[model samples]
Target: MSVELNHTIVHCRDNRESAEFLAHILGLSTGDEWGPFIPLVLANGVTLDFATIPAGSITVQHYAFLVSEAEFDTAFSRIEERGITYWADPHRKLPGRINHNDGGRGVYFPDPSGHGMELITRPYGGWPEGSPVVPGS
Candidate 1:
């Protein structure tokens, strides 16, 4: 057997809302409620198990997804349709824009739970030697 990401718990003010938000944006489906969790499984089989908690008790988290260009286009359209604020940089210095970092498109936004969300078409380390480098790459 090899090591692989299986699942992770994400604390949200409303598990269902958070799960549904991400699912709708990514064009995925959520599993039936199990215990306190609302599961959203990724294409790679990694499930993000959303659980409800007090809003004040929830800690911020960051989740970055490497997506195909088509998936990015679809998800980005959904974000724009919802008027979600996005940035070209994770630090959020550049607003209302997406970065062509690593020779691919990337954007940073926030999830319903306030978790930092990122979508990129290319892995940071896969960038060509002369490609523009984004901070933290």
Candidate 2:
């Protein structure tokens, strides 16, 4: 049997809003809420379970997604349509720009809960062909 990550809880100010926001960007649907969690499952079966926490208790978190070129285009359009600010780099110094790293596009933006969200078409440093650990490995 291979080990896999099933899910992770994302602490947010509002679970429903955060979950819905990500679901829309990824062109996915939110799953039914279970208790305090509002889950957004990815294609790999890894769920991002959003849970509400006090706004004061929330800290900055970074979430990155490896997306296809078409998916990136759609998501980036939504970001622009929503008037969300984005940057080519994580520090957000390069505003209104996108990065072509490893021959793929990437952008960084902040979610409503202030989480640093990233969408990239290629893995940093390129895909790991023989690394000990790859995504979903």
Candidate 3:
């Protein structure tokens, strides 16, 4: 059997807002209701289930997306257009910048719920030519 990730619940202060925020970033639409939460399904069929919770009761989580170089460019542009802060490193040492890690570009930012959102073309380790340093490297 081929196993694939389907969905995961994202506890947020406001489900609709969180869903919309993720949808906007990923260039997807806020999907219709599925039980008690709002969902944003990716092209890969992985849905982000956002559930509303009491204020100050939500915890921060990290979610990374492996995108193509072209998708990275487009998403980075969107991030910039929205004036959202971007960091080349996970520690947020170098702000407002992107990294050319593993011969590919990557960036990190936070979502509305304070969840760490990352976009990377390369995972880690060795990369091709002209690869940018993974900040602090």
Candidate 4:
């Protein structure tokens, strides 16, 4: 009846490790391995199927997640605990810090596959007043 994003393939050096890394950071559960894929499904029902590929086969991709404030706190804590270097800017100009953009907190970090991963408490430009932005809508 309508278009939807079911899943996407993410090329990584190690599927299991990459999937687990993202799942843990985002506080999501890893799905059972299917064939060569290790999946991490989001709350919106979109699955990221991680697949092991040759080294240097994938170009760096950017993934941004709009999380709740509580989720952002938890994930940011984990990032600090693991000593993962982060930046306030996507260009990585401001190192060792998170940004407060659109009146919400956000941080950018790299996954094991070198993909840029971001977590923000607000959507870009912020959601309109008196309305909510549904994920995957």
Q: Which candidate achieves the best lDDT against the true structure?
A: 1
Q: Which wins on lDDT, candidate 1 or candidate 2? A: 1
| Cα shift from native, residue 104, model 4 (Å) | 0.9
Residues 13-101 of candidate 3 have per-residue lDDT tens digits of 88998889878877779978777799988778898899998868888888888888788877887888888988887878788778887
Of candidate 2, the 10-residue stretch with the lowest lDDT total is: 128-137
Go through the candidates in order and give each one's C-alpha lDDT: 0.88, 0.87, 0.82, 0.85
Quality of model 1 by C-alpha lDDT:
0.88
Ranking by lDDT: 1, 2, 4, 3
Per-residue alpha-carbon lDDT of model 2 for 11-130, expressed as tens digits? Answer: 999999999998998899999999999999999999999999999999889999999999999999999889889887777767888877777888888998999999998899953343
Model 3 CA RMSD to the hidden true structure, in angstroms: 3.6
Q: Which stretches of candidate 1 lie over 4 Å from their true place?
A: 126-137
For candidate 1, list the clashing residue pairs, or say none: none
Model 1: per-residue Cα lDDT at residue 134: 48
lDDT of 2 at 95: 81
User: Which portions of model 4 show Cα errors greater than 4 Å?
Assistant: 126-137
Report each candidate's C-alpha RMSD, comma-separated, in the order given. Answer: 3.8, 6.9, 3.6, 6.5
For model 2, what is the error of residue 70's alpha carbon versus the real structure, in angstroms, after optimal superposition? 0.5
